[model samples]
Target chain A: MKHNFGAGPCILPKEVFQEASQAVIEFNNTGLSILEISHRSKEFEQVVIEAEALVRELLHVPENYSVLFLQGGASQQFAMVPMNLLPEGGKAAYLDTGVWASKAAKEASKLGNVEIVASSSDKNYTYIPQGFSVPSDAAYFHFTSNNTIYGTEIFEKPAVGIPTVVDMSSDILSRVINVADYDLIYAGAQKNMGPAGVTLVIVKNELFGKSGRTVPTIFDYQAHAKAGSMYNTPPVYSIYVSMLNLRWLKAKGGVEVIEQENIIKARTLYDEIDRNPFFKGTANVEDRSRMNITFVMDTPEQEAAFLNLAKERGLVGIKGHRSVGGFRASVYNALTISSINALVDTMREFEEKTK
Target chain B: MKHNFGAGPCILPKEVFQEASQAVIEFNNTGLSILEISHRSKEFEQVVIEAEALVRELLHVPENYSVLFLQGGASQQFAMVPMNLLPEGGKAAYLDTGVWASKAAKEASKLGNVEIVASSSDKNYTYIPQGFSVPSDAAYFHFTSNNTIYGTEIFEKPAVGIPTVVDMSSDILSRVINVADYDLIYAGAQKNMGPAGVTLVIVKNELFGKSGRTVPTIFDYQAHAKAGSMYNTPPVYSIYVSMLNLRWLKAKGGVEVIEQENIIKARTLYDEIDRNPFFKGTANVEDRSRMNITFVMDTPEQEAAFLNLAKERGLVGIKGHRSVGGFRASVYNALTISSINALVDTMREFEEKTK
Candidate 1:
């Protein structure tokens, strides 16, 4: 079994994959393939409801929030956030900590005014910006919880007094979260959830319809919430797979339990990097991500040699994002402790052989 | 096996279902589930490209058109059509044939002027409105070629001088279409293609950028077409299942052979409805859809009693749409001749019991 550490479409539980494969064959023994069953059927509706219920149970989502599994990814939300919240002639504040955060601001720029309150671009986004006060007059303060490309995570939700929104695409369910901390939380399902297709959106109901323009119904959260995300045919397979993955997460003692395991995985790799003179960690230790551990070797040749060694040991997708290249080990909830250990052994053996 | 008559996601070949199920467990034997592989990976990129190619080959699409597999269902396309095609202050004509067509018009009304050139709502949408003229000054003529609820279909494209737009959600691929007749064609994948979640949009590359507003990248046709529908993580499972189904379609001799089989299946059911004293088809005989065959019994009791019998005989999803309270047997391309024969036998047996 190869160790997969690709960023986004990272990893999932084997049992979930097995169950999903069975569903694709015959869901509830209905004799109809899951791919060909009606989305309006009772069998499929249960999947949607169960997925939403799991999200609520795992995260302790408050009653005021409406959880939606909508089409389009985080990129679509980049445009939808401004279209739904930034009223005509209104301004919004955003934090720029990575490529995705900057992309979100760019999409919002076409809708209304977006002011960058703080940015870590000067340091190549190696660390999360801190201690910047959000403008009280802005429509909402938006930020990304984790920088996937640069391996940085904001440990605490910014205490922005205004309505706060978060694009938690990469680190949503990796740890415990107080749903009330933000007015809206959005994430693409490719990371910890299931697959790429449906996006998860948790929005406080009161923060809608304030945008001055007539929002398209498909893009309107109120429309999706009212219809329970069935305004049309949803991506049924994506939702079903996600339900399986979440059910597995809950079975493994929920996010609280998973977070501890994640901390161990992160520490194991970071400690190895710190102990070995040949390796160096990329992000500031204080702002390092528990989900993605980014690191570099002393030289390009050494980095290439280490990658070849990792490959020989069945490690795959460990390559970092091309823009910030070296290596990234994405230890999502589904990535096992044993896989990380194997990767660690690969690195140690390479060091011993070279020395 | 039960006969499925639900409107979409309806029936698909068992072979396609099996292949899709296997893909979920282990795609291309890469030890990674199809749901876990990166979309940018060469393995998945081929799936996207091949699906587009099959769409073009089966539909005989013109060289000038671009095919896209996009997130969101046909309802999203309802709004996207206008957002992408209708210019500010520009009027477009429409044929409001049924609930879907009216909904499309409603969405278009939010974007620009949508003139309902003709409608059959006055008659409960029992027949297709014909001989209506498309305005030369209008942006384009929009119409739903098949009405799943009303069970009516336009046998021939309206001879319009302006550009044409078609929402072929429920009936595409059941029959052949002249690619040159329309400026754009959009369909939800649940019906004739694959599953819900991914919509198929085929557009003439030129009729873009005329919509006076800056369309959000997610809704912008030009943006999606340019990016090959990977502007973000697409519904990967949906697209992969679609490819498997399309490959099956091609192996069965493409649309020509499939359409012939579809006709035989429709004929078997429609013949029984017309010949039996206890039942009658509701659609105009000339305009009745070979895709969705709408019918009624001699009385409500007979309809209810027959539905019970059909259920007992393992028939699934034969209930009529609520608005039209008879029964609709949606026999899309994937439904088999033997399945329709079984439905016909059930109806005949019920008649014999009542008589």
Candidate 2:
């Protein structure tokens, strides 16, 4: 048996694959493949509408927030968020957690005065910086909910009275959050949501058209919101698959129930690492990401051995990011507790062999 | 039996769908779903690299021209092309054919000085406007290769002495063309390529960085081109489907073979539309798009009856744009000759009933 723990574009529910595969052949009894359907037609419009509604329902988003299904990953939102909200000299505070946070900060810097209020980069982002304060005059406070590369997460989101924007690309739908707390939240549908082509953007409608700079229509939140996310042809198949995944999430007790299962999976593996002397977990204990668990061996030789052995035993995508080399097991929402148990068993076996 | 005629997010080949379905279940004998693989891992990277290389090979693109797999569809490129290539305070010329052309023109107007050098809007864009002169000092002359909504195409791409950018969203890969003819060519993957979520951008490296405006990194063509389209988590699943489709295209006598099939399909339908007194062809003969065939009846009652009959007979998406008030049969690359024949038969039957 194989377990998939790749970070983004990671594991999805089996039912989603089965249903999406059938849809690819024939969609909605229309005798047309989902790939061939028109986005404007009533059949596909239902898809767009329901997908948006499900997003709102799943996240418990308020009526004031507009959920947009867009293209480009979270990287696009880094630029879009600032382009639509920041005036020429307006400042937006950013909390730099890791690679994605820095990329977002870089994009915003070109649009306006991007103030890096707090950054975990000083310590290579091994922990989420805490006690950061947002500027009262700032347009918005942007933060990455989960850092994939560094295996860190903001255990407690900062309270910024102004509009709060988050790049939840890696952790969306993995846990529940107060949708009302955030003015805008965007996530690339790769990790826990659905697929790679779609990005979900939930924004407070009242926060738009404030940017003095002429924003591109495609990048403007208002343009997408006004068109109901159909300003242009959206990522149809990806969005559909996301809808299926969201349906699965709903059926599987929604975010509230899934969060407990996720914690169990993450805790089991982390506990094994803590007890085993040969292996060490990365990230500050409180800031460690429940979704992606990164670990390293005491020696480089052991680390290489473990990775090769893991792959041979049908355990995959455990190699950590090159920037922070080690091993990473992404325990996303789809990752079953059995998979985590198997990994714990592998770790125990390797330790026994080494001893 | 259903015939899909939507301009984009349109039809795809059966074999491509079959292969994609299988891959979703088990990719490359890994026993893991394609969604489970890591993009950074060698396995997934091979897929991305090979897909880009295949596009370059199929188009015969020059070494200097970089191919970028981006998100946000070609509409994003409408703004990005100008934001990345238009010099500060610089002017650009555009040929407005239909809705998409006007949309791009509108976006460009917001960025810099836009010259509507030519427009078929005078004639409700029933035909492509020819004999337009582009300014030598202008950054570039932008035009839509095929107007999906209006059913017109500029078959012989205008040789504007300045840099030329074309939105090939509707007819890309339908025929072979000199990749060097334009400075930039972008197509949304849903039409003739694969599915929605991925946009293919082929651009000359030298023409970039001319726009003195600070382009948001996501909008910067250079950033994507330099990174070999891996600047961010790309539209992985969409691009993967595109690779499968392109591979199928290459196997079926490449673009040259598909072009012949496309020409035949368009000719058969247009002949029926022109010969029948009950219907009238919408586009001028010289500018008729081989990809999208538009027509209308003498009366709205007859038009509604024809559409209703067509839907009852398993014919779909043949209704025209509301702005145009007619019927449009989008004969994209994946549209079979049998489907067009079916549409022609439907038209003949409708003509017989009305006459």
Candidate 3:
């Protein structure tokens, strides 16, 4: 099997993928393909309920926080966040860390005033900016915990009392996080969860039923929370696969255990990059993401050669984003330590060959 | 497998569902589940291209139109339609046939002035309102082609110069449709195409880039048309299954052939309902949906018993929506003739036993 490190729509546990595949064909031995089963059916209702309940158990989510599997991904949440929370003349604070964070801020700008509390753009977004205070007057403070493109992660959550919103797409399940730290948390379920369609939104109920604008029915979080995320036919297959992955997480001893393993996998590859002469790490060492490890070869020709070499070693999706071209090894929760070892071994062999 | 007539997240062809399930396990033998594959990968790009191509080929979509596989289903489109097409201070004409149509109009009312040009709510939405004129001054004339809840359908296009928008969520692809008759058409993929997450939107490019509102990036048609539906990581599994289902539709001799089968299936059920003293169809004969066939038993107790009998016969999802509860057998494009026959036979057996 190839070592998959492609960034979000990244790795999922093989067992989870297999179970999901089985469920697709015959869910709970209902003799109905998961795809064909009605979302309103009792069986699927259990799937939704269990998925939500698991999220609460895993995250230790406080009471009154709602867990929703919504469609349109996190991209939709960019607009929805502002549409629902930011009133007609409201202002919100945003941390501009990377492409996605900037995109989220931009979406909010179209709806209302968006104040950039901090940004790392001047430094090519290699590290998360720190020491910038969010205004209490702002409607909410939004930040992305991990940057997939730039390979930076905020190791420390902003210690503030303001309502915080974090887009934890890439690093959601790979680590243990305090659910009570943020008022709202939205993550695209592609990485560290299940697939690309459904977005997981964990929002506090205190914020619900209080939007100032005439929020579109689908964009309104209060409406979704009230209806239990079934205001319409939800993305069934995506949500079910997510449920299977969550089950896998629980079986693997939950987030704390997985987080330690993820740290180990990342350290192995980063240690190799630091020791090897032919390669250089990209992101600042302190803020480098454990999930997405970015590095570069000595030259473009060397980088090109190493990519093919990695591919030959059954390492796929090691090629990095074009904006920061080199390599990105996304070691998500599902990527095994052996896969990271394989990638590290390939890197060392490539260096020897070049020398 | 059971006869899946559940109103969407509905039935898909067995072959298509099987193929989709297989793909979920290992897509293209990449050892990566289609669920876990990166949307940026060439393999997935091809899936998206081929799916869009299949849509164009099967529907004879015009060169000037853009086909999008979007998330958020049709409920989001209720707001998106007006957000993309309805100008500021503009008014649009809406035909309030049933639940979905009214929901669409209600969403539009939040954005701009909505004229309820015609409504069948006066008759409990059991028939499509006819002989109503569309206002030329309106920005668009919007309607739902089929109402899954009430078993009503609009058979004829509005004879108006205004742009036409149809939410074909329940009946799309079961019959042939003229591409030029409507400027834009959107359908949730669940019923006639694939599943509940991905929505199919075919919009004329000419009508785009003309909207007066600053549509949220996710809601803007022009933005999606420009990106070719890759603005976000799409509902990958849903779109891929839709492609597989669309391919099946083409192999089955396209919509024309399927429409004929649908007609026959509906006829058999309607014939049985009309001939027997036990049941009666709810919709007016001329406007009753061929897609969703709604019927009621002579008494509430008999209705309960018939549902039990239908379930006992390995038949399912024949329960009517609560709004007009009795039975709603939604025979979409993927529902087979044999399944219809099974439903008919069960009805006859129940009727004879009760008598």
Per prediction, fnat is 0.78, 0.75, 0.80
Clashing pairs for predicted structure model 1, backbone only: none
Q: Where is model 3 chain B poorest over a 10-residue stretch in terms of lDDT?
A: B207-216
Per-prediction interface RMSD?
A: 1.1, 1.2, 1.1
DockQ of all candidates, in order?
0.78, 0.76, 0.81
* Alpha-carbon runs more than 4 Å astray in model 3: A209-211
Give lDDT tens digits, candidate 1, residues A88-129: 888999999998999999889888888999999998899888
- Write down the DockQ of candidate 2: 0.76
Kindly list the per-residue Cα lDDT of model 2 for residues A193-215, writing each as its tens digit: 89787889999989888786678
- Where model 2 places Cα greater than 4 Å from the true spot, the runs are none
Task: For model 1, state the Cα shift of residue B324 in Å.
Answer: 0.7
Evaluated at residue B75, the lDDT of candidate 2 is 89
Question: What order do you get sorting by DockQ, best first?
Answer: 3, 1, 2
lDDT tens digits, residue span B212-277, model 1: 778888888888888998888888888998898899999999999998898888888888998899
Candidate 1 reaches a DockQ of 0.78
- Chain B TM-score for each model? 0.98, 0.97, 0.98
- Which CAPRI tier for candidate 3? high
Task: Predict model 3's lDDT versus the native.
Answer: 0.89
